[model samples]
Target: MRIGELGNETGVDIETIRHYEKIGLLSVPPREPNGYRNYETSHLERLAFIRHCRALDMPLADVKRLLDFITHPEVDCGEINRLIDAHLHNIRERLHSMQSLEKQLEVLRARCGDSHIVRDCGILSELVAASHKTGVKKD
Candidate 1:
């Protein structure tokens, strides 16, 4: 099938498929006489695996490592477990940081109290005060 057909089947963009091929994540398919890519079932399956990994927010390098493991069935999967654990740990840290940011935004949002005037906006006032405190000169 053509690249567009492959993308339609996988819900992936054509440019992204090309990017994956460029980065050696997705294998390049053979071209037909017309020079259009002739993707096979293997390409579809590999693309699907890559898409699933990306959906899980796995980094490309990690996805590549996972793909390498797929080609070697005899190896222990302990490395995969460790990789997933590390990703989970990173997610937890991000969640914690996001919660803290949410709290800060909540406090900042409270400063405005409701719709007033721009001059009476406590949020802007606090921001300006913060910039001054941090020695940030506004252009």
Candidate 2:
């Protein structure tokens, strides 16, 4: 089939499919005699795999690494496990940071209870004071 057909089968955009080819994430298919790019079932499968990895929020570099591993099944999987563990650690760190941010926002929200104009808002006052302490004058 053609690029569009392959894209439809894999649910990937044309540009994304092209981008994957350009970025070495997907192999470029051979062209037909009429010069149309010819894609096969293997292309569909690889595109789906790429899309799944992207949906998992895997970085492109990691996706490439994973693809390399997929292509070389004989390789040991210990490194793959290590990579996943590292990614999990990074995710945990981000979660912790987000929780801290939520706590900070909760404190800021609590500073302004139900009633106050912008000028009298405790949250704004605290922000202004904190900004001044940090040498950032808020207008």
Clashes of each: 0, 0
Q: Per-residue CA lDDT of candidate 2, range 1-119, in tens?
A: 99989888888999999999999999999999999999988898999999998888889999999999998999999999998998889889999999999999999999999796789
- Lowest lDDT sum, 10 consecutive residues, model 1, at 130-139
Candidate 1's error at 121, in angstroms?
Answer: 0.6
Q: Between which residue pairs do clashes occur in model 1?
A: none
- Off-target runs (Cα >4 Å) in candidate 2 are 135-139
Alpha carbon deviation, residue 136, candidate 2 (Å): 5.5
C-alpha TM-scores of all predictions: 0.93, 0.85
Q: Each prediction's Cα lDDT score?
A: 0.95, 0.92
Q: Root-mean-square deviation of each candidate, in angstroms? A: 2.1, 2.8
Provide the lDDT at 13 for model 1.
99
User: Taking the tens digit of each residue's C-alpha lDDT, what string does model 1 give over 33-128?
Assistant: 989889999999999999999999999999999999999989999999999999999999999999999999999999998897899999999999
